[model samples]
Target: MKTMTELMESNIKKNYVFSFLMNFRLSNGLWMIYMASRGMSLTQIGFLEGIFHVTSLMMEVPTGSVADLFGRKLSRSIGRCLSLVSILVLIGATSFFHFTIFMVLAALSYNLESGSGEALVYDSLKYLKAENNFISVLGRQEAIFQVSSVVALLIGGFLGTYSYHYAFWASSGIIAFSVVYSLSFTEPPILESVGRNSKTFRGFLKQIVDSFSLIARDRKVAFLIFFVQTILAFSACIFFYIQNYWKGLGRTEFQIGIYLAAGSFLAGLVAMKVQRLSHLLKEKKVLIILPLISVASMWGVALCSNKLPFFMVVAMIEAMLFVAGNDYINKLIPSRSRATIISFASMMYSLVMIIFFPIFGRIADTISFGVAFVSLAVMASCLYVLSMYLLKKIG
Candidate 1:
């Protein structure tokens, strides 16, 4: 049998490219929000983000089923190309409408990514007879991705200081690099059986319906999906608020970059150890406990008077919980319909956020950012309790 290290080495080139692209993509996650704040009102920024979320929600199921029926490599390549185009459009965008167009494209790209790339990697490993090491390998890959985000965010902050457009251009270039890397990849044979029947659009629809029916019938799966959606919605709220909070701390762009980089770097480190963590805790328990910890940490940050403590607490919580939660969700999802399930869950979460984010942003503007944080924390706390009840009921 091929050892895990040997199998990983066999595909190191493709894996590195995928990890780099992920890092490049996430690097701008925070900076983009900060940029939107500069040229628009907070409500407008929230609305634009909501539009992105809406588009992603619409595209998720279709793109996910495409990956399942076609091939992961093809889906990933198309997604990367779409991402490149979106970045180029973002670079040229000057108005809210223009930003909306770019957001739509970006959302579509994210939908394509929902299941394709990671699924390809998983299938590739299985072909190599290294499926047993999926969690560890995935964790390692995520760690690289986080490191890339830290670098990208740092550079993006510096670039944003000069011009926000520069950051978009840089992202475009990075995505192009990803495209080249993706083209060089060879799809594994393990996925050959998956796409045996050439699925028509109607067939795809049937698959989607069947997937939903499965979720509904499997109470464990349905509750897990709901639990994950709640966690993601709260996470989005925290991400949306944190930029404004950092500004309130009298921090510069460089300072903001440093804080983000520190947190992401730590998170990346933790992600590498996720497999070990899995050995110690059940995936469901880890999911619940980590988010609860995140809520408490957010409350601490919101209540803190000092910047140092606020930054430290926020970074620690984010780094520890985000990876743990994601890994847990990954475990719960079935590989056969991974993308579709993930997209379905993401769509539900985004739908919730689309309704609430604008309201929350307006409240933050009229009242206080602290109130926004506190309210979200309270909601997350309630959701955690509900998640526990669901887990028990389902079991």
Candidate 2:
């Protein structure tokens, strides 16, 4: 029989392995290009992405609730299975309806892990009495994600030059490893001890109410969730759409891959330093700096002739905030409601994406990428000002 220390170590290490496998999504960087190749307009692609966020918005919380009430291991295993299925569907999809199905499946896969995985890792660390290390651990996870992204984008871009199907096929194979790793995870005692009664449907609803009620009452947690997710939504909008924009500029698959891979590499480096940076800058300064970075990057992408520098900066900012913000919010949430509340935070990202993605896509289709970027800059700046105001009021 394994000791508690052994079990806790197993859970944490296994989660890293599972995360590495799941995020090694070879088709991620080129999926937009693949859809465009299928004779879908950028506007059509935008709507498809909108469908994804809508599904995520609906499913994120429920799936997270299941993870909290049931087991993170089971939730993760199911999500990996769904991810494999989604990739298979993407491989054969031709029509918009087929793509819609793929998007929904993909979104559900994302929703399942969006909060469950974080909660699992955190609670596992908590079991080890290493909860204070969560931010540093989160940084390592982000670094792992970028490492996977670097390899996937390089190979997927190469495969995409020949056939997008090949890239997606490789993605499916990678997700199978995720499934196997997820099943090997030992559930943290934290959830079972605190969440035993929250397994029923009524219990689930109560969990939701209590979680949101906590958020509603906690200004700092609410601010962290909204501020982080809102900026993240903006960053994601740029990253995906930039794939199309770069293609429109006549960049080859290999070159586009290099561009994205470079950003991922830089982000990975930044992610590893998130804890150090946070400590150095202090919390308030870090918060102020991140929004300014977002605002400047957007405008740079819009106005400057060279956008790659700005693009790469956005990637680093994203990695930094994701690690730091998750640590902050998770510190505030109780164990029983942790997954659900974090999922609610994730749902905010989906909500913002659903609203902004289609609008930006329409603008890009009708106007120009420059104008679309400018629009994002303006929106980000306004949000920053409002966020600062709110922060000041809370202070």
Candidate 3:
């Protein structure tokens, strides 16, 4: 048997490799900008966003189940391959139709990776009886993931200034490394041995149903899932448009890159401190209050004449949604359906994104960013009230 130190060292290596690869997309900070630059309308961009989520909503649960049954290492390898192709397609895409098609493929790539890595690391720790480290380790992994994104955002901006093609090409090259890493990455022997417990299709379907039943019966789980899905989905759609919003504010491409990099740095720092914050506030209050803070910051963006508050709030949103909230949920869930249940939350977010992204896009096109954001704030406020009822029950 491997020593705990040995397993942890391997796990951290996999974590950084995958984390870096995941955020290394060259189109990330500039995608909506690139699409718009090609003469696509705001609504068109929104429609593509909706399509991406539709793809993800369809695939999230099944791919997650596959990870649970087969092993994260194999599932992640498949995801990395799809992600690589998706970026290549985007790099070569010349028309709106091509972009849409490539985005659908990219959605598939995200699903394959979504719950797989977290499941791998968490289960590996469980097997090693080192569950205590899961939160801090996961938090650290989550935090630095954004650090890589700062690199991607800067790279995308720098290359995109000359030509978007350069950025796209560079992103694909970075992901090539991740693809190799994924294939070579080892699953914990315990997880590899789980294939023996793999279920038939019928059994898998039953497990999904039972998982939904668990959600239905457990108000805390259901609420947490609902709360995270709603706010994250809303904020994600909002964040995507912020690139254009910056353009509207008279910022140049390079200036936008600097803003993104600065915000990302703050987000990384906040994510690293998530465990400490959780300890200070406690998880229940964290869930309760952070969402409120997130909503307020989002609304503050709409209300502010200056964009600095929006940038600060954007950092908070990233830290809260991606890093803090996710680790908190991980702590609550049992191992057996961990990936499946997390995917369910993710799937729900995809569904919400599908429904609302286009609507918000149209609003931004027809009206203004401020008006669209105000609408989001109203929706978020109502949801926050409802979430409080559920958050109280979690503990």
- lDDT per prediction? 0.70, 0.89, 0.79
Task: Point out where model 2 deviates above 4 Å.
Answer: 191-196
Clashes of each: 0, 0, 0
What digit string (tens of lDDT, one per residue) describes model 2 on residues 1-395?
Answer: 99988998887777666667877999888889989899899899999999999999998889988888887778878988999999999999999999999999999989888888898889989888899999988898899889889989999999989988888988888888778778887888773455556677888888788888999999999999999999999999999999999999999887899999999999999998989988999888888998788789888988998899999999999999999899889988888888899999999999999999999999999999989999999999999999999888887
Q: How accurate locally is residue 339 in candidate 3, as Cα lDDT from 0 to 100?
A: 75
- Per-residue lDDT of candidate 3, residues 68-128 (tens digit): 7667788888988988898888877779899888989888888888888888788777777
> What are the models' TM-scores?
0.89, 0.98, 0.94
Best by lDDT: 2
The TM-score obtained by model 2 is 0.98
Candidate 1 per-residue lDDT, tens place, 112-133, comes to 8766766666666666666657
Deviation in angstroms for 266 in model 3? 0.3
RMSDs, each prediction? 3.2, 1.2, 2.2
lDDT of model 1, residue 57: 76
With candidate 1 superimposed using the best TM-score fit, by how many Å does residue 179's alpha carbon deviate from the native? 1.3
lDDT of 3 at 163: 88
Ranking by TM-score: 2, 3, 1
